[model samples]
Target: MSMAAPAFNLRTDLDAMWLLPSLKPRIANQLAGLVNTAPAWMKNERPLVSFSFDDVAKSAAHSGARLLAEHGATGTFYVSGSLVGTHSDYWINADRDDIVELIRSGHEIGCHTHGHLSIANATPERIFAETRTNTRFLRTLEPDLKIDNFAYPFGRASPGLKKRLATRFHSSRSTRAEVNHGRIDLQLLSAFPLMDRKMTPRVIDRILDRAVQTNGWAIFYTNDVALQPSPYGCSPALLAYALTAAEARGIECAPIRDALLKIGAERTF
Candidate 1:
């Protein structure tokens, strides 16, 4: 990494191009290519950076997951039980075979929810039920693995609900973008949400330099990859920028959960 890289200005909001019919596949491939070129050591490290996608969508199956496999990078897919087979959700095209393929590809399978809901309104018991049900269903798919990772639907959770989730799940996520504090709160893990093509290469370079300066972890969450008609996917050019930025900095990119795991569990206060 060189000092020549400029300061990056971070922003929220996915690109609107994902909603378009064309340019989807191309962008998807770029996402795959980004992952396919990753370094090996970063794939297994303490405080490593990795990619994860929430809400099973076609872009996840066709674009995002593909790109992750290309780079030999593994991501955790948190899917809602109800949406697994439904064809109606924005990008949750539960390709049964693809879901199996993702598992076979060495990716982690986590739960999003039985149905998408914000824990803001639900009681702690309700939150626990939601997470438990999804995890139970996911177990049928892969009996040997433990369901450790969870993402709060809509990034909503209360303190009480957080406690319940922490007791049951290893980690949870929200839209907050920063490095993990190396803790296991299971409620407020920082995440960078992906929307259309707003995240560009130049933008990614800026973030990596900042993270290096701070020595903090950054985890990016996306709904899908380069699938067409995307209202929340980044383009290939942009996806590669972020991935390459990590590579350029000599920082290995890895799955978010694995990164923290290598650091050991965070103590509960």
Candidate 2:
């Protein structure tokens, strides 16, 4: 199946984007972790876990929020202001009303850039520019909204860019698959997908078990939720199942914003 093309043209270098193009940012991410860290003093607490939905697909706005709320938890929605109410290569984006509903229902709104631009594909100037546009656009939707978190588009960020983001948001999430534990870097908090392409129930169960054993933080991200989801998304049933399993394990489920507070990191904005 052909993917739906994004409305805006991507300006990434096609040559540098070959064979694990994300590796460039991944390396920079590792280096950034060494310096300019927002250390989380996550001690004497139950294992923490957060569910985040990127792009805020229509299905995610509906089924994703419903499932989390049913479990008495809320997921973070990392939105691209420019993509709202549009059809993407994956799924139809969430509309303005859905954004309002999510805020009203207690879900978080994190920045994902104005046009969902991949950090690997954008220059430092464009990165800052896009970030500003994303925040400004989201505020236009609701004047008093507080966006204190961000997710790197395509799970990529340069060292310089990561340093800049660290001062701006409470936390910046990445797509690296690792459990966050003991003196972790808040700027590039690690997370992995819950989609079929990357994970299975048994795999997620083990991830939850590890978090429980270590008193660590397990952050999982996804895109859409429906009977048929995109490659970057999971089915509604899988989402519900993951939540149920986490709850069954007695994991403390909270949105990224709330979970950060519990670990002794305060939102700067």
Candidate 3:
């Protein structure tokens, strides 16, 4: 099924906003990278790759998860409880059944907070409430579900949020584009985009090659996988190409939780 085309180019709008004269957003992101770091040592013996979906659009829950399973792989789906079964402007969010099925099918379900609020400036109390609400909602669907990891909504976070989340989650991913290598920040892992407009065969090859060269963890994130996708999503063909390329390169594809355990990543507190 074709996704509705967005009213405006999402990427272009984002770029324009980020390029504003103040450059505050860029500066804040840089600061986020440097501060509130919960360091972890990655003693990986091989390259690792993790495919994740943020806000988990319906297509991603169905098509994206199916593709990963077909490749003998599983992905992490970061879900916001409030967004579940809701229709957004670009795509529909995954429903409760999708969440249950994901867990049943061996995929990881990470927290994206209850309201999908950006925690960049949220108070600790608010952050706690949001996460707790989300946990409770998810557990309602699957009693044994353990939401271990988290991803920042809109890829925005503050030092205080990171510090607080560190205590609650094993790891938290940001939208920072890079291959995580050597000493890493468990609270703020970097991830590359798997969006339709951003990823290409050559780009995928380069990313995989870098991960192989550094024996690093490469996490690719997107929202949906459909023939026609939102700006933040990718086509199924693109997703397949990525999975196939990773397999060819002998990269071990895993969910974030498994990857962390495999790498023996211990908190440096």
Candidate 4:
């Protein structure tokens, strides 16, 4: 008898994100050392690790917030204004005040465009509307909300796109978390996707040490932390390990927007 073919074959550890204790502690120590030894100009007023959560998933409310809160750290949640009030399963389930509470606590609320998409395929008008319209919606929800921070929808940035958004946004974040040593490109800042499960703490520390040595701003993005986390999320164990390591050192976590703003006022990309 012949067997039927499988309908689908899923991948295992394809993303290569995981949390390793030894590596994380090393990174934590290295970061603290760099902060203590770095030159005055390079050293930010506050030693900051910017934890940013994308898509504003429901898990973020727990995993992201709890870990940061445990260490008295502040994080940034970049929400898509259009997702609000929509009963879409793909979108998170939370109200305006829920978001407001996150802000009211110690976190910062930032914009992630109206719809998360790539600029490579988006038209100029669409880009402006997505960036500008959502900011308006965020403001309408909370009259005093300040739309200072922003990030590219799909980690893709173009010079032309940067020029368009320069006047409207203060700082823009991206997924290129190597280091920010050279001229800081507001439109093309760097970040590491902490939620990628296969990632090792050693790998994370390697990246962190390099970034801290250069006095570069390192922004880590995530959505959840669980053993069977989503494709773009981390496990709770890993999240705790990383946070513990970070805490051992003097590295305090701050929302991405506040981190930049604390360093200095925003500038054009």
What is the C-alpha local distance difference test score of each model?
A: 0.62, 0.85, 0.89, 0.65
> Which has the higher TM-score value, candidate number 3 or candidate number 4?
3
Candidates sorted by TM-score, best first: 3, 2, 4, 1
- Highest lDDT among the candidates is held by which one? 3
lDDT of 1 by residue, 77-196 (tens): 888877777775455566666777778778877778777665434556876788778877777777776667778776664555556666666666766566654332334666676555
User: Which run of 10 residues does model 3 get worst, by summed lDDT?
Assistant: 20-29
* Number of clashing pairs per prediction, in order: 18, 1, 0, 12
Worst 10 residues of 1 by lDDT: 35-44
Clashes of 3: 0
Model 1 misplaced stretches (Cα beyond 4 Å): 1-47, 181-186, 227-229, 266-269
How well is each residue in 70-182 modelled by candidate 4, as lDDT tens digits? 87787888888766544444335445766777767767887788876555456546777887788787787678887777777766655555556676777677776565544
Q: Can you write out model 2's per-residue Cα lDDT over 1-269, one digit (the tens) per residue? A: 99998765344543355335667656665676566456666763788889999988999999999989889999899999988999999799999999999999989999998988865677656876888899899988889999999998888766777767776788999888988887777888889698977789999999999999888899999998878888999998788888889889999999999989888875434
Q: How far in Å is the alpha carbon of 191 misplaced in model 1?
A: 1.0
Q: Which candidate has the highest TM-score of all?
A: 3
Return whichever of 2 and 4 wins on TM-score.
2
Better of 2 and 3 by TM-score: 3
Rank all candidate structures by their lDDT, best first, as comma-separated numbers.
3, 2, 4, 1
Positional deviation of residue 178's Cα in model 2 after best superposition, in angstroms: 1.0
Query: Which has the better lDDT: candidate 1, or candidate 2?
Result: 2
